[model samples]
Every structure is written in C-alpha cells, then in structure tokens.
Target: MNFLVYAGVKLFTLLLLMLAGGLFLKALDRLIFPEVDFAHELREDNEAVAKVVAAAILAWAIALALVLG
Candidate 1:
C-alpha cells in the first residue's frame, strides 16, 4: 500500500541520517583533536574519551529528534 511505501522511505531516511550523524561526529572529533586518537584511547579504557563521545552522541540524538518532530 502507499502507507507501507511511505513508512519504508521514512525508515530508510532515518537510517541514513543516523549514519551521517555518526560520520559527522567522527569528523568533528578529528577536526578538534588532530593528534589524539579516540579509538585508541577508548581501547585503553579511557573514561574521559568515552564520556565525551557519549555526550556528543546524546546531543546529536536530541538534535535529530527535534528535526524529525
């Protein structure tokens, strides 16, 4: 039905937006911390890096929710 098609497209768009948001976060991290390796830090049990990433993700989710609404 047309509703099913619309729902599928909306879901696909949401998935793409989530992927883009993650890439944006990664790019922002690299831009802000050119020398620091967040992946390595996270592997080394760096709480600070985890917290920062979590905060960024939360912020991104909030922004997405607002936009979607």
Candidate 2:
C-alpha cells in the first residue's frame, strides 16, 4: 500500500538523520576534548565517561525528536 511505502521512506530518512547527527557529535567531541579518549575510557570501564556519553546521546535524541515532531 501507499502508506507502507511512505512509512518506509520516513524511517529511512530518520535513520539517515540519526547517522549524520552521530557523526557530527563524534567530530564535536574530538574538537572539544582533544586529549580525552572516549573509546579508551569506555574500554577501561570508566563510569563517568560512560555517563557523559549516554547523556550526550540522550540530549541529541531529544533535540532530534523535538525538531522532527
């Protein structure tokens, strides 16, 4: 049906947008904290770094939802 096709397209678009936003955040993270290695911290079981990463992801998702809604 036409509705199914439309829904699929919208889902794809949303996925693309999320990918772009994540890449932007990765770049921004490196720019802001040049010395802090997020991957390394995460591998070493750093809770504080994990929390910060989660917070950043949640903030981005909320902002994206607000914009798309």
Candidate 3:
C-alpha cells in the first residue's frame, strides 16, 4: 500500500512535469522561430515531441520506483 501510494504520487508529479515541459517547449519554439509554423510541424511529425514527453515521464517513474522501492 505504501509503495502504491508513492507510485501514484510520483506518476502524478511526472505527468504534470511532462505537460509543463511540452508547453514550455512549444512556447520556446514559437518564440525562437516566429516565422516557422509550429502547428504544421506538429501535425507533420508529432513523434519528436511525444518522444521527449514520454521519455521524461518514463525517467521520472523509473527514478521514483528505484528510490521508493
């Protein structure tokens, strides 16, 4: 039960971090490349951004599991 609680908390935290990171990256891209079309880039290839967010969440989950376990 304690492990479960810790995992849940860590998962939630990781998700929030992923979301914030995604938004921040998007904003940064827009600010850096105002002339470039972000929406088109995202539509053309979402895998890049998805991979980043997924990796962050996965890393956090693994770290939390190792520390909590």
Candidate 4:
C-alpha cells in the first residue's frame, strides 16, 4: 500500500512537471518567435513535443521509483 501510494504520488508529480514544462516551452517559443504562429506550429508539432515531455516524465518517474521503491 505504501509503495502504491508512493508510485501514485510520483506519477502525479511527473504529470504535473510534464504539463508545466510543455507550457513553459510554448511560452518560450512565443517570446522568442513572436511572429512564428505557435498555435499553427503546435498543431503541426504537438506530437513531437508530447513525446519529448512523456520521455522526460517517464525518466523522472523511473528515477523516483528506483530511489523510493
């Protein structure tokens, strides 16, 4: 039960981090490339960004599991 709770917490944290990171990246893109039409770029490249964010979250989750399990 404790391990389950720990895993759940880690998963939740990982998701939040991924979401925040994705938003931050989008904001940075807007700031750096104000004329680039990020919404259109996002529509085209969302999958790539999602994959990168997922990879990052997964890495963090795995590390947390190893350390806390």
Q: List model 2 lDDT by residue over 1-69, tens digit each.
A: 999998898788789989999899889879999899999999999999999999988998898788767
Quote the lDDT for 32 in model 1. 84
- The clash tally of candidate 3 reads 0
User: What lDDT is reached at residue 36 by model 4?
Assistant: 68
Sort order, TM-score high to low: 2, 1, 3, 4
Candidate 4 displacement at residue 31 in angstroms:
0.3
Per TM-score, the best of the predicted structures is: 2
**Candidate 4 C-alpha lDDT tens digits along 1-69:** 999998798888867866876687678768977886645755787777567556755876686567555
lDDT of each: 0.87, 0.89, 0.71, 0.71
Clash tally, candidates in order = 0, 0, 0, 0
- Per-candidate alpha-carbon RMSD to the true structure: 1.5, 1.3, 4.9, 5.1
Over 4 Å off in model 4, which ranges?
A: 42-69
Error of 3 at 40 (Å): 0.8
The TM-score values for the models, in the order shown, are 0.81, 0.85, 0.58, 0.55
Task: Tell me which residue pairs clash in candidate 3.
Answer: none
**What's model 3's lDDT at 39?**
65
Off by over 4 Å in 3: 42-69
Candidate 1: regions farther than 4 A off:
none
Report the lDDT of model 2 for residue 2: 100
Cα displacement (angstroms), candidate 2, residue 10, comes to 1.7
Question: Could you give candidate 3's per-residue lDDT for residues 1-69 as a string of tens digits?
Answer: 999998799788767866776687679768977886656755778777567556766876686567555
| TM-score of candidate 4 relative to the true fold | 0.55
